[model samples]
Target: MRYTLLGVFCVFLIFNASQTLAVDTFCQETKTLIVFGNGIMNSEPEADRSKNRLQELLQATLTPDEFKRLEFAIAYNQSYGLLRDLYESLKQKLGADNVVTSFWRWLGGRDILPDAVQQEFLRVAASFDFSTRVGTQDLSIHLALYRSKTLEGKKIVVVSHSQGNFFVNAAYVALHSGTDPLTTNSFGVVSVANPASFVAGSGPYTTLFEDGVIAAIRAATVPGIQPPLIWNLTNILSGARTSDWKGHGFLDEYTAAGSRSVNKILPDVIATMNGLQQPPQTVQDGIITATLTWGAQPDVDLHAYEPNSTHVYYAHLQGISGRLDLDDVTSFGPEHYFVSCSKLETGTYRIGVNYYSGSGPETAQIQILAGSSVRNYTVPLPSARGSSGDQSPIPVASITVTGDTTNGYKFDIVGGL
Candidate 1:
């Protein structure tokens, strides 16, 4: 009887181990990704140089496992460049089976011009052959290629720089807006330094344009399909204006100008994708909390880096005096920001605040009426301001709070409590 029991136990353990392995394999298998290169992908005189640079950059940013799952597609500008050379280079790096290179010789041959200047060229070129236009035709061809038997059951990721964003946007509109949803063309889009204005009320296809292309890409979602999370990286150091249409045309110019380092940008791209794969967090309370520890200073003043800047700047500028006041607390410590609700609920919430220093140990009190009692805490600031009459008190840094409600509650702060 003892011998028989041992055998059964061994069998059960083996079965359970196999089940765990199977789950892991399924997750790894589902991570299929494709990378698309923009016009500059092949601009280098030597195909090998361009291909190797891109491959090395990708290798550094992605894990070996992630690198294995990625495929590359190079879109070559037709006129002065040789599409065949670019294709050959990409094929060598990504393997012929995994790379798809598309070239429009007539369009690529035309003189490089600004978007407005190239309008006539685009009309002439797009009219010639449906497959010639990179935005519409080329994208359709690529989608078809993606759906081919070789790529079945694979997830899609489009990485486009500069003008490539335009082409991909056009393709997204074409595939998504119509009556018949192009389920086969499902994929996430990553726009690097794209300058296109995403403002609403811009044009006719604006709704479709924003929804299918920019917004969907950002959220990583498509209608009737799981949204592929999208990432956009803008470089502040590159000196390239994020809004300039001309600046986007030449990738080399932007890179040379130092808008952002390639090292910094590439890592972020890979990290964003990895983050999406992690299981999402569930918020039990309407409240969400974040804490920042002060190292060098006990008190720090938070302010908008620039006056009249949009809300987005609140996160961008570091070490600026922008005051984020919670209720009446005029000055608070630098370490903690919190949001609380009367009851627990399921929803999303955001907390924004600016920390400033006036005097004493830099303490603040926060009260949420939903729950009983006020929460008191000391936030460390860097150091006290020098005793000078000329120096101004720290400016107001803004903090924004957004969340769904399980119950309604009012929030206020008592500064220097």
Candidate 2:
């Protein structure tokens, strides 16, 4: 009889524990979530379209009310306005309406144009208003939306990726000195795969992230101006999908040429569109990190061209969401670029180096950091045949992945052209 009573008590205890350990469901917060996409998102012809695409990316993870609060419609400055001019230029030259369905690579018009035309195109692009280009129009629209009555009283959270984060930084600086009507508004920010570190350099078309999302955090904490929350999910390019959400990864339409069928972003990123919980706080060790170093005198640029044809280089800092972390023009120095195998779409990533300036022959170093292994390669650039200014076609390193990163990733590397 005593044994029967003890068994009943044990069963009761197990049931109680199980009931208390139930999963916590996501709840909707009374705030508005806004997304500031990299170059391409803002360029979408319409706001409703971008908003819907974001919802689809997050549909698997977000509740209906949570989805309703999202607003990709907020107006912000659009970078690559130069691309508009270039598109028109190319449209006129090619006399083809389909100059390129997407502008991710701008193709640098490499395949179509003569060497001199490409040079001219580069010159025009590099000369555009880089100094304050981000702060002017895109940021202005973003601030206006914040101050608008529509978003009043609602918490405002910004999820900025790549170049989008640059606009966020400018907004902080604008609010640093004076007072804005929306000063007390609940504001939060999250920056993913910040290209600011690579772009910040004095090199042409380079941007500065001011060393990661700390810039956003510090900006939020300024006296008289503090957002309710600020979290930076740095370097999430692990070459795999960023979350468990279906259809999540870097870019769904990563194929670089022609019209892309979708604009779905990684679902892990979509979750953080409102808050900081979903993305891991720091970069893990297993991700791939590449460092490129060359003598300071030559304007040697590291170009990592995605299998999709989007090239990551000085001219284009954010290519298919990968980063060119460092670019050196003044000295023989170490420049680094990194992306998680998770963020790397399954394809061949062709890494190459260009002799931008300095006439002499130079040896380039490639350092790959993965798991517990570190491999380094020394590549020599062929002597400049003539007075070639910036277009030296030398391949340095290549990394390819053939399978799903989650199930098990198969990555192969080739070090030379």
Candidate 3:
């Protein structure tokens, strides 16, 4: 009787342990957020640091209950030559029980080549297994994992930076086509400095080149795979030429174009995730117009023109100032010209002029025209007499237009220095 009782007790213990495991293994209403780095994912130190910082930021943004229900996944070191390491690390962090963290490598077998060589290699390699494995194959694997019993029914958020975004887009396409199992669930994607280029133009992936990728991401329609909501965050300090490989590995070293603040970017990301905001949209159809003028200057003959010869003037428009070309404007005139009221779409704009003098004070009247309206402005030419003679170029500025969309107005002209 004693031996039988002991055996029964052992069985009871085993049953209880299995039950506990089962409980921990299932999360019915959990949300999964996958944060990915581009090239940095391959660098251990950078990846770990970025992950820690992002986690802290997320903690601050999410409520206690929401945070608890959220599962975080970071993919690093997988795109380079470190595919296996990236896979193992994600598995360990997510656990063999309840989570599915997809690990993909877009730049796998070609890691041995230098940057210059890889560029050429990727063009041809796009057809090879190495490219297929990381780019499309790995994504397929991830889909299968997501469809497995362990991860079914969970909400997924894919946060990828740089090249990783490319992989995400490809995965999205594959899933939409019913080529992958995990594509059956709804997923949200947040892409930062996504190398896809359509976000800002000019990158490893040109804007035109990435349009197809965007279309692919948009095509996803699996029952389980939620239509992806893509959020693109561009670096305002760095111009559009930044490399995905470089930016992901050295974020601190590079700044975003247009001087966008980093602190603001994170908050914007959180707000977007919480459904509190939408990405900024282009306010105006493509159109830009500006006016030029010179106030009265002390009459000096053609000789006077010589004194002011060193002085130069130009206009600059910030933000979406339309497709107006600088060369078009520069090629047109008697050096100075006037633009009549022409329709301009809503966006940011600015204008300015410079002055120089051989010795006398001169002034000129300036008028700016955009979309059937003229804003009169003035700038005084300084006398060559004082230190003010060397004043740098003055930037005339204006308020950003918000909702104007009338089109095809002519820019009429006036004046020269």
**What is the clash tally of candidate 2?**
27
TM-score quality measure for candidate 2: 0.35
**What lDDT does each candidate get?**
0.34, 0.45, 0.36
Query: lDDT tens string, model 2, 285-304?
Result: 12345666665455666777
lDDT of 1 by residue, 133-212 (tens): 44543454443333321223454555555345556566556645543334543455555444243311121110111122
How many residue pairs clash (N, CA or C atoms closer than 3 angstroms) in each of the candidate models, in the order given? Answer: 35, 27, 41
Cα displacement (Å) at residue 18, model 1: 45
Tens-digit lDDT track of model 3 for 244-303: 342233244122222232344455446434542222211211122332323233221110
Estimate the TM-score of every prediction: 0.32, 0.35, 0.34
Q: Comparing candidate 2 with candidate 3, which one achieves the higher TM-score? A: 2
Q: Is candidate 1 or candidate 2 better by TM-score?
A: 2
The superposed Cα distance between candidate 1 and the true structure at residue 112, in angstroms, equals: 16
Candidate 2, overall lDDT?
0.45
RMSD of each: 24.2, 26.6, 28.0
- Once fitted onto the true fold, the runs of candidate 1 whose alpha carbons sit more than 4 angstroms away are 1-31, 40-52, 77-135, 149-151, 177-186, 199-264, 275-417
Scored against the true structure, residue 350 in model 3 reaches a CA lDDT of 43
